[model samples]
Target: MHNRYSLKEMFFEHLTRFSAILVLFFLSAIFIVLIIKAYPAIHHFGFSFITEQKWAPNFELFGGLPAIYGSFISTLIAMLFAIPVAIGIAIFLSEIAPKSLKSPIGVSIELLAAIPSVVYGMWGLFYLAPFMRDVFGGNGLGLFTAGLILAIMILPFISAITRDALNTTPKILKESAYALGATQWDVIKDIMIPYAKAGIVGSVILALGRAFGETMAVTFVMGNAHQIPSSIFEPATSIPSTLANEFSEVDSELYLSSLYLLALILFIISFIIIAFAKFYFLKNRVKRKKRLV
Candidate 1:
């Protein structure tokens, strides 16, 4: 029996190690491919590939400034709208919901994440765009509309992760706070949030990552205009949206390479954001541990 248990443990350990290695292998492969494919545009356009604002492919000029600007603005708008609502929902679900209602509510929230991106795009294009047009004007397909759709799409992800983080708070800490005559809000604001700060930050970063890379929904409602948006109501294009719209139609090698370079830029941006989040989380965690000690 002892020998069998040892063999079983060894098998599982090797399996897990292999899985981790496989993931690293795939990531390295993708990074290498992006560097190779994007080299032409990077070499030809140099720094201007990212700095220049015009994307006149007919004249063999391509610039990612507008797409990058659109991506940042749209993500900012989405986070502005999403963060408060997501936090509220997370707080309610984790701390306030009755036992009988919690399961159903959680499931419903998660169901939003399960919906296909294309379905969200279709709904945004057909329903939300018209509503926006009538109420806020500008043909409705623009940065604001895209941001709204992205907010809705990322809401479930942020809320679910936040709720999970909140749920992990120690029960004894809450009980002690309650015994000290602290109100529910005080407990949540002081104990729960601080204890789960790292996880909450992680959730927000994950949501931001999702918002940044989102393609289909943003494409459908973003109007695909390859120019910097002067206003939230003006048409714009994001990096993902640009790639989705033009990847198939490009006839020039430079244009194709430029698109790959855009993809590489996006990958680098995401990697940097994730790395920052991880560093921040670790630093805070260490500080908290020292405080506890």
Candidate 2:
């Protein structure tokens, strides 16, 4: 019964939908291409490629287990360090920060994320590596240093998102908590954290994805060793770093394909993690709505 959109408005709306479909199709096409190119490695190594850790060029043997493990462990360490700090920052920004201090501080934290990845790597190499060596009393490059750098890189991401998530909490919820005689800490620990848990987790997943895929920062600090690390202080390699270091020199087609397969694996891992995060977000959103009702 209302006035319909003009011809240009209708055309623009359809264009937007079609553009989104095209973007999805393009992404699918790229995935297919990468898989096809990587088929040789998958066929040659079978599933053992994922499990076997040795990556020797002399015997023409290769596997990504070590690299994958490094990526996982480094990112996990980053999470252990980043999550608490990011949460603290978020909590302060959302509830405890003075009105005058909030904007400047938030902007500064986000500016950290805006720094170039290469710049982070260079700093990791020159500045962070030396600091780690001085503090930890060992070699400059190791899983720990890589992880520390990754944490610095991922912190801003999680903190910014978490702050936004917490800020989005309904004012009525805070009022209700106050009416119930809940202390500020109690309200935050119970009402606030639980309500924003889903979004915080989504932010974490995104940060973890960045950690797993990070190349320059990790590579500069990881010592670029392909062997399995015995401790967090030991030098190691990650899948992305391995590819970045060696893909250009992979003389054989099988070697090249194997590298591409590693990319595929990373892509799949990220997709699954993000999907889980999305599931958590949607589940919590429903739960939050029900609680309101």
Candidate number with greatest TM-score = 2
* Model 1's TM-score against the true structure: 0.89
Per-residue alpha-carbon lDDT of candidate 2 for residues 139-182, written as tens digits (9 for 90 to 100): 87988999888998988989999999888778899889999999
**Global CA lDDT computed for model 1:** 0.92
Best candidate, lDDT-wise? 1
| Per-residue lDDT of model 1, residues 1-293, tens digit only | 99999999999999999999999999999899999999999999999888899999999999999999999999999999999999999999988999999989999999989999989999999999999999988899899999999999999998998898899999999999999999999999999998887888887997898889999989999999999878889889999999999999999999999999999999989888888778877898798889999
Could you tell me the lDDT of residue 147 within candidate 2?
A: 89
Q: TM-score for model 2?
A: 0.90
Per-residue lDDT value at 138 in model 2: 73
Q: Give the per-residue Cα lDDT of candidate 2 at 212.
A: 86
Give lDDT: candidate 1, residue 144. Answer: 94
